[model samples]
Target: MEVLVNNKLYAVQQGITIAALLQFIQLSAHKGIAVAVNNQVVPKTAWDQQQVEPADNITIIRATQGG
Candidate 1:
């Protein structure tokens, strides 16, 4: 399956959940990241239940601390 991450296309295994995808990208769930799939924001509670399909557009945003 092919999914877009941060505007880049990546090949991932079938039946991959959003949580799994985050791990594959080497991103920590503790980073306070937000995810939107196909233009809809997915809540953290739904990450484990959300399955990503081929051609799905996934956008991940992380919060940064600055002064």
Candidate 2:
């Protein structure tokens, strides 16, 4: 299956969860991050349950320490 992540197309396995996707892309889940699917913010508690569908739009925003 393919999904649009941050406007880029990525091929991922079907039934992949947000948590798995993050790991697949080598993102640091330990850090503060925000995930949104199809314009809806997905709470951290739901990452393990949020499944990515084909053509779904996923946005990952990681917190930065600059001000």
Candidate 3:
């Protein structure tokens, strides 16, 4: 299945969870990270439970330390 990640298309396994996708992208579930699916923000605690559907729009935002 293919899903949009930060506006880029990525091929991922079927029924992959947001947490899994983050890991696959080498991103940790650390502080200052936000994820939204289809324009809706998903809570950090729900990352593992929310499955990524095909063609779903996923947005990942991370905070930086630089001013």
Candidate 4:
């Protein structure tokens, strides 16, 4: 299956969870990170239960601190 992550195309396993996608892309699951699926913000507590579907528009963002 394929999904768009941050406007980029990514091929992932079928029924890939949000948590798994983060791991597949080598991103650490920590603070300052946020994920939204199809314009809906998914809570961190539900990442493991959120399953990504084909053609799903996923946006992964990180909070940066700067003066």
The prediction achieving the highest lDDT against the true structure is 3
In candidate 3, how many Å is residue 3 off? 0.3
lDDT at position 37, candidate 1: 97
Q: Who is ahead in lDDT, 1 or 2?
A: 1
lDDT (tens digit, per residue) of candidate 3 on 1-67 = 9999998899999999999999998887558999999999999999989899999999999998986
Residue 41 in candidate 2, Cα distance off native in Å = 0.1
- TM-scores of all candidate predictions against the true structure: 0.93, 0.93, 0.92, 0.94
Q: How far is 60's C-alpha from truth in model 1 (Å)?
A: 0.2
For residues 1-67, could you state the per-residue lDDT of candidate 4 as single tens digits?
8899999999999998999999999886557999999999999999989899999999999999999
Instruction: Give a tens-digit lDDT track for model 1, residues 1-64.
Output: 8999989999999999999999999985646799999989999989989999999999999998
| Positional deviation of residue 57's Cα in model 2 after best superposition, in angstroms | 0.4
Candidate 1 residues lying further than 4 Å off, grouped into runs, are none
Worst 10-residue lDDT window for candidate 3 reads: 22-31
Clashes of 4: 0
Model 3 C-alpha lDDT versus the unseen true structure: 0.92
Q: Report the Cα lDDT for residue 49, model 1.
A: 91
Global Cα lDDT for candidate 1: 0.92
Which of candidates 2 and 4 reaches a greater lDDT? 4
List ranges where model 3 is wrong by over 4 Å: none
Which candidate tops TM-score? 4
| TM-score computed on alpha carbons, candidate 3 | 0.92
Backbone clashes, each candidate: 0, 0, 0, 0
